[model samples]
Target: MVRWVRALVVGAALAGMITLAGVVLGRIYADPLLVRLVAGAAIGSVGLSVGMRRLPNWTVAPLSATVLGAYTIVGLKLAAGQADVTGPLSQIARDSLVNGIPRLLTAMIPVQPAPDTVVVPVIAAWLAGLAAAEVAVRARRVLLGLLPVVALYAGALYVVGPNASAAGWTTPAFAGLAIVALATSARPAHAEVPEVSAKLRGRAMAGAAAGLVAVIALGAAVGPWVGGQVSASPVDPRRYVQPPQVDSLDESPLNRISGWALSPEQRLFEVSPTGAKSRTVRLRLAVLPDYDGITWRVGATYRNAGRVLPQLPRLPDATTADVRQEIVIDGLTGRLLPVVPTPTEITGARIAFDAATGTLIRPEQLSTGLRYSVVSEVQTPDVNLLPAADVPSGNAVARFLAVGPGVPERIQRLADQLADGNGAAFDRATAIEEFLAEHYRKVADAPSGHAYPNLDFFLFGPRAQGGQVGTSEQFAASFALLARLTGLPSRVVVGFDAPAGGGAVTAGNAIAWPEVLFNDLGWVAFDPMPKSKNPRPVEEDFTPKPTKPPTPPSEPPTSADTSSSSAPPAALAAATDGGPGAAVIAGGASGSVVLLLAGLALALVVMRRGLSRRRLTVGTPDERIGGAWAELRDALRLSGRPLPAHLAATEAAAYAKEPSAVRIRRAAPASEAAPLPPLDELVAGINTVGFAPGAADDAQADRAGSQAVAYATALRARRSWWRRVWWSLHPGPLRWRRPL
Candidate 1:
């Protein structure tokens, strides 16, 4: 009976190891690892139970376990509609095998597998378990039994390399545990049989264990470095990624933002703002008000900017210019055609407009060589003549003020701090604009992920701190987010920034800025990011107009500032001026790479911790106990000795066939963790919990859980500093798992 129990326990340990290894999918799947561990437990227990029964053929028990485990997983997913349960059995098999192939191929890892799609992995895992059980129990060979598990681990390693190290050693861990269980349980088929002495057997086990640990250590430490060396040099993936298709099947103007930011050589088009135009001109693509905390996108559909195209909103007493800008599209391809803000008329075939943004749209997919001319009525408002922002009666006002989800609380506070309480909206607007210009820096490159993930990282992520967020999009998005919190209507504008000589707009000139809406000035643009000086005028030509040679300054130019003979360098002076286009992008290319790498690392830590917590609280009574057990292993990995990959929990604890780190000192040298009676009790209580049919009870399960909590606290209290940092990334259960 004791031997059978030991075999079963080892089987369970193997299950755990494979499950942990399987968690590599967490990075790819949206669903958590808790869901997949179900299959791990089912496979392990079934194999062990059938084997312990002394079933007829060794293959019989393993094959039965494999079939049973596979069916159970498929049945569960089928019930969930992950796979089609309505289809004939053969058809379901065909779909799971055939249709699932491509999905598994292109599918990213650690991903949440689909109902039907996950079937393949589940079956693959079953086969692995079957092979493992046959070797370990029937053939009774440790290395061969571990082969299938090793294959799974190696495959996971090849797929993600070091990135999957968070759960890297599960296979060896369980296999060692299984070997110990079998060794301890062995009493020979015949009592008279003599075999290798106990010491030699022990030495063999030790050598095998040492080899496994060495293999894992090398792979974990050296694999990524090797992979990096062999692979192409690291480049920011976002640099190559096309613009985001903002919430539509068809591309929106915003979709091309990243491409524009990354490309400086390619020209999107040339804007001739031909006649009767202000010195400064900004082409409008989209005016977005709907911010779902991640992206800014237009919620409303297209309407005519005017009966014809490019019509500006009529403002009372506002000086309007009847201007014409001829735009010649280049390499850019999109359904949305770029236009200057407030065009009075646009001449083109198949052009539409969204008055919401004063943008022109081409319904068809864009092709090169597209041309359009716009006749616009632009409102040129000077600060002195413009009215102070006052209350406006417009539907647009409310939409602009609506704040999205992830606007950090600190940003809102900063906005309030900078804005004057008694001043009009314009005063607040100026203050905010100036605040961004002075406080926020601009970089030429765009950062990936949502603009602001961890505010601390964005605000103080780099060693440079204040200067890290230096990009037009960052400047514009941050300003818009803050302005909305300040009770002003704000949105981000993305469009081509025509060079000063208004001849052509290159991809480099694709810039973004904030536009705040006021009752007095409709969507007024604010340039918070610095850019190069535009020529005095973006006109047809700057050829020196025939000038009377040398009229010279009226008098020898007297020193403008007599007190200051030494002026600041051009770059330093420009940076200190605190205006849009004042500061050059700081290591814009490298900054993006740093941000991407940092974000990826942070995300991995967060997901690992969250999964650890979720695994503890979620599952059936047996499953919950299993979760707590897994959490204990995670905790031990930090505070206790670094678990050797080949050592099962008991072996690592320096014991045989005993689960849990019953004696912490064995795994942790000089360990001061107090004896946890509850831990021992919990381990003993769960001896039957879900290991076999009808082996669990409410009382046993509850006691085991309380003991787990007690043990966890005691174990974690004694961790070293480095371990404590690791522990932070493995958060505890703060909330009870909702019943699944």
Candidate 2:
């Protein structure tokens, strides 16, 4: 009973380690909490339970691991809406199982829960948990349990690489080590312990205290160096590049409101419009026109010469207000430089501009404390005089109005549901914008478990879907996607914002909104995220309504020409863009984790096999009797008697008086009842061979060894599942390694 409790306590500790690792790794990849917790708990409980056992250790470990791998693969496929059982699961096995251990060790930490992401963590956590249980419960080596827990953290660090905070995850692992110590200190026997005499045990307590401190100090000193040397990012970028990195941005649609609520009170950057602006102004970073059903991004990118931007593609009849804005970047993050819409010129030496997308970029990554000025003609169209595209035409129309597959028909139906089938572009856009304001609720962080592409969830999901609630990105993505379905050339724009009343901007100032293109008006912006009360009208910077606007800059590019110009780079024109661009590095000490587990598994097999063969197969005649006797005790355990501490082996023996008795039994299935052999005969032989060596009968000793092995094998075959579990936790050999 005490031993069983100790085993359970150790199992609990291992489960905690797995849970902690799962949560941390999941967060880095933006996996939903529910998903991580459920998966972690289910896998950890089973894995750790099996690990703490001593019976069937060889086959059990391998069998459990295979099941874990299969479960993860199948479950993920089901959740992803792929085929139920065979096709998708088989493909996953084919892709990942060939190099099973290798691929698992090499898998990347994807933000979304992809197949590799799900399988690798479950398999790794189970393996680690099993080791922790075995070390703590079976070996009764408390300190050794830390090995597997540490290895677990190390594997996570390698996979997560530099994506999240490393220091934050180590605290729980250290706690698990403490639990290991407590579990290991408990004796496995059921009997009560003799009271300790204080005087005699005085130095024992002190010595243990000192030893613990010394071990902790040693771990702390070594941990940093070892941890720093490991990495999980994919080493082969050319072969398997992570998507392009999105710095400090969680681009999920549900993040909309939190971004708005971003340290609004804390100024991240300062902006001063050269000319007093009419209202709050937004500093455009990049105009993303391509929607891959999930997110929006710039389709085409180009590097402009430092500071100088090419003239805005000549709009025919639109009024432009040149506003010079000086910006002092404080604490904000992103690679693209910020400028007000319609930038005519930028004053900086090391900046590059993408003329087609109107994006100002630094050759490398963005930095803090950046100060720059921009010359921009912020455009606002005359509502009455705005270009009328009853039937819009231009080369860029198809590209601007493009819709990716999987867009639900409900989105298109919503447009028709709200307005007449046809209306002027401006009127239709305004109606869509108003409809969004009226129906959707603006939520900063949506609950976990929202489906992927999340479009369906945003539009029609439950309450949390009592109303559509999401961040600006979702609103913009949905509105733009929906707007495009209605024949309005629409796209989503993401950038830094400078409101009229505020002098400084913060993370909350990072914003996204929808934009529509008119042949004569170029691209126009609008707001779709719902407001708390009376929603503010979308801002448009216009020189007071003008008559007969300036005309004839040039005819808008044709659809064919626009597609040719604004298309994404040929090298990266996939359905999904901006993933870690070769960022997951899978080499180094981190990459060697799989090799470690593999080596450990192999070494265990060889050790167990060699030990068994020596004890049961071959040895000197007398040695065989000792070996045979040892085998009989374990055989009883496998037979399910297990000889609980209160039961005496001598009293329980069916025959303790005879040395020449033969007690071999044939092999049978594990579920049936198998009789225990004549242990008295085996013990008598052991006494003769071990104490009165010269008097030993060689034939009797060999026969006992052979019969002992055969009976143990039969007992093993007839062992029940629970019996196997019981001995697996406290197998006799586990205690053979006396304390150093």
Candidate 3:
């Protein structure tokens, strides 16, 4: 039952671990379902395998450490999007040595956008530590081994940080070395305590040491080869670039209001005239005081709004006038109170007041505390200017105009009326504008809403229809549409009305108006709002100086080829206009430093091996000749040759017929001399004196063994050159063959 419970616990833990891994990987990579599932399953399996294991705490500790450590390292890389490192383990070690611990640590850290490759040793080391910990005997030791693993987990948080690449190696190496040390320190089976037997243990240690050296060398060599493969793959540039613009207005109500609102309280103009002004001078200035349901953009051209009457006098030519003035305002009620206009266009004027709202207006609500100056062009009639045919259509400034609601019908009607029986465009447009302006009554109070599909609202509403006055937006739309109907191009312009009295106007005092397109003259402004005897021109208070357009930034060169010395100075200058090449240089220098360190490590390992004592005890001539011949026969079988049945030792030697065999025969005792030592005697002497048993005490056995080893070494040295000759002279059931 305990075992079943353990299994159940393991299963539950596995499921939880899987879920955790899935969440982590999903968040990190956003990979497809299949990929994420596979990754989660693999990670969970590792965790489950360790959790279910029955072992001492010490052993279990290292294994657990290794597993979690590897997972963390791999997880970081997976998150960072780097490809796995495919080179040998030794190369990873070498890289650690040269680049210092930082780079390796970085490799371990997971970056937001993962790289194409991940380091495999980091993962392997982690797994090794985890596996080792699982078998640990003491809980304390397990905890101790895991301390570094915990630190590594903490370090991974910074993997995607600036030093991420440098931090990657820290946890993996710490975990790996700890596991290796702990595993090596553990006792063998049946041993109550750890003991290091001098002779046997020394040999084992030597073998392990040699194996490690070899692994390191192999890894170094293999790492570059693997790196080469990775470098050979192509990279796509477009994958890393980002797009250009994002709208700032949609989500914010403030921005929306700022972008689209048109309030009449935000004065449209302040007017004053030069010379003897009349007691009642009509103030004419374009005004679009409020925003209706439809939006009015900056730039678009439209046809006239009403019928063209050829019987009307010709309209005056377009002209421009700059007007400036000031008016005192009442702050308590936010109203423009009546004040005598100095240098006013008309005298004896009294500002009309809206008693219900405590506001003053000459048909429009005026905002308080605004000051501005404006430059506008008005076409004053001269000799009843005759309307022309052939209306002008295209104009560049027309792109900046836009219409409000109810605009399309007005434009169509104006266009149709102007084009009436007159095929020419200019005459039709002129006729339409003149007829509409002359017929439409300029009233301060129009109905709350204009009549749908009708032109009577402006002519008869409010004072005529008994409803609250319609806003300037409705009036402008109606006017612009009718103008377009007569073939005249027109548009609605939204801005602020600046009142005179403040120092300088700001965006808070914005206004709007309607503009019509004319041939050669561009957009001409005309105000349809009724004016009092003492008129205030809106443009005079807020006209600002023209601003210069901004210059574009230059782009720098990105390609290394362009920066080459042979390129002209101008070419180089042009190429470098974008940004400096510091990143490229830094990366190259870093890579070079890594390579140098790797090379130095390899050289050190080689030099150390060459200086070691084990390298000095190789065999003498007799041993080489005899042992080599035997080894050569064994090798022949490995190479797929068959040995002869019923072959005597002497026969086998004769069959080999090597030059070494001739040397062996010559070295043997004569028939008369003491009988030659048996092969068994020689074998025993070699095993006891040279290899295992002490040889220092017996000079004779030592000398004989030395001679045999020397002979074997010499035979091996010459074997290759003599192989063909020896085989041709004597062939056995299976001839000796060279290794492939």
Candidate 4:
């Protein structure tokens, strides 16, 4: 009865620890389903571990596996609504397994609790609970058992990364429960100790309690000081993980602006207000931020997403209206999904979303009759704050300030002339927009292209030289690049101006515009279209008489003369800013190679971890015993020391090795970590399992597997930190048939 009570406390503590660790996922994924899934997995694992404590070790592992699979299937079915689970079970399972971890890192947050996104967290919590309970309760190695729980908590922290800061109470709560579990666990019955007098025992207990109190008080005083010294931004793991690539992203939407203009009357799509009606809606299809002289492409990293898309931080002084619209595709093509600016929620279709760019894409092509619903938060900035608003600085927005090489010197001069005397970034942005609208002409059939040459001709080429007339494509691109050259941090957007009050959107409504990024206001739209008063409405076709281009005095408009004694050198520096020159591009290419190698290295680690998991968890009793020894051999090879293949199993312990400095807790030194529980016993078990058929049982197999992992961990820990890291990441053992 006493043992049963003790087991209950330990099991509850383990389950609670896993559950507390799982709260980190709640921040990453907003859905309440995560709560149910995590709690269910934690409780179920603990119950199974306690129930199976009396069973043979091999039988217990297989039973646990069976239960875990069933739990996952049920949890997934619940995540996908009952009506939505009409698809084949195999498809659901495949998607869950394939997208489980990959999408979690790349998906925008707060991620919806889709089956794929929830699977990883649920499984991790379950496994952690089961392992920790089994070790603490059955094996009676309380400290050793805490390792799995610690790993789960660390993983949760790592996966959440910089997305969310954990609550203040979480760490302290977990630590407190862990201490309780340790205090409550029953000691081994085989332990023998001399009896101590009551007085001495009380004194010893008092001294230990006083020491713990002193440690806690000291930590309370020093913790805040140490925390203040650390960096504000946490290390984000998403940087190392490559985002999903789609072939359709290669097709630039900016290139299609002119083509759409030629067929202006063709219906592209239609939008109907599902909620509050609005006077106008701007459905953004793509945001083109990257330009390499030839073309502007969408540089967003789109990841698989669910109904609730990630939203930007709301500005305190900004007024926002939620406009919900139901959109139906009529003649739209390609994979780009059009949504109103600053979409907060989406439904009616599966999509990949890029939060940074406020863009969405259907992995599959958009077909006629396809429909989706979107809820957008249209921001109304306080005009009072516009004049004083600043632009973001540092490496975060540096890409927006970068200009491709070979910008015409006249364009820079013109930008300077237009934006002269404007102290604020917003004022300069409006000045440029006002000048372009008043000075440029809009033509119905302007040719496509927004390259450096094209923009130069539009801004400075003589009228007779095919200059001064182009489509919205040229106007928007010119504005964006020119803004970059003036250090305003801008990007071009390719979208449609749907009819006022929401109706059919025709190709005629296809428009391009520039948006300037302000520190507090986000991306504020600017209209540089000819004859345009605001971002809405593409103007009707207009013809203009040819005008002579203005000629610069003394210099004859040379491209090399980007500087002048007139305006701020900052503007000229931006125009001539060799941001990412040839050498930088070369270094970027080199970095790509290094990333590819690192990805391959990570793949090897995953493959090896999977192999190790299967060897211990799958197969018959005899096969498991043999697998344990094979694991040890691989560990030996990875640790930079391998016994000869020809060496007999009995000779394993006798292998020569020098002592090392590192040690794993109270275990043997690095040299002695190779042999545990007597090498002779391990050798005899392996021989019996391999040759003496039917001689090994589940209990013996389980023992060998456990011993192997402990041995491997200790052996690896003995090396220097760098060598240990390399040992974990190295892939040489996978290709080698035998260790030397």
Judging by TM-score against the true structure, name the best candidate: 4
Lowest-scoring 10 consecutive residues by lDDT in candidate 2?
A: 655-664
Off by over 4 Å in 4: 82-87, 188-234, 245-251, 274-279, 301-305, 315-318, 382-398, 416-435, 438-440, 460-466, 517-522, 532-740
TM-score of each: 0.37, 0.37, 0.23, 0.62
TM-score, model 1 to reference: 0.37
lDDT of 1 by residue, 1-740 (tens): 87566556656655654565466544434455323643554365446544654766644755566656566555545533531234466565566567554444333233334434355556556666666766665565645666776686555444444333344355457557656755754665533324756667688899999999999999999999898875544332223323223336233345455556676788677777454334556677666677767766766445322124424457655677666777777777656677766765655434445555666666356676767677767785655643444634244366776655555544544554554232355666676666556544455564533345633244434424433454566667777876665556788777766643468777887777788765545667887664333212211121224435666666543456423546556644564666544234656766899999778668767786566555545556677666656555444433422222223333333421123332232246554544544455455544565346346565665666666555556665555444445555543233312121
RMSD of each: 30.7, 38.5, 44.5, 29.1
- Top lDDT hit: 4
- lDDT (0 to 1) per candidate: 0.55, 0.57, 0.36, 0.75
Per-residue lDDT tens digits for candidate 2, residues 1-740, read 76676666666666666566666556455346325633564455445454537675576666666666656565556433321112455675555445334333333223334443355566666677666766666676767776876677666655555646554645656575466657557556555345645654677789999999999999999989777765434333223432233333423322433454545565667888455445777777667776666556565444323233556665656566787877777765555667777676665424445556676655345567777777887666665655354434445466776667655645544554433422345776887787777666765564322222476667665553333566676777777876766557787777766765547877677677888876566677788767555433221111123346467699876756644746566524432454543323444455589788667667665665566678756767667676776666554433322222112334425422121111122243433443545566566676576467867667877777776766665555443444444433333453342110
| Minimal lDDT window, size 10, model 4 | 535-544
**For all candidates, what are the clash counts?**
25, 29, 146, 0
Give the runs in model 2 whose Cα sits over 4 Å from its true position: 1-263, 447-453, 464-467, 531-740
Q: Candidate 1: misplaced stretches above 4 Å?
A: 1-255, 276-280, 303-307, 310-313, 385-387, 393-396, 420-422, 449-451, 454-456, 465-467, 499-502, 530-740
How well is each residue in 1-740 modelled by candidate 4, as lDDT tens digits? 88788888888888888888878667777667886788888899988988788887677777888899999999888877721333677787788899788877877777777777788888888888888888988887878999999998888888888888755788889899899889888465554345756667789899999999999999999989878745566678888878766464445798888888999999999998544455666789999887777778788898877787777778778998887888999998988888888888887777788878878887678899988888888888887787878777556776786667766666655554444345457777887887678767777687788888888777766666567778899999988986775558888899988765668999989899999888778888888877742322112212223457677768564554445566467656655685655656788999999999989888988988887888777888777877778777766555433433434566554542323112232443556455433344457667786578788888888888887777777767765555677777766555545321
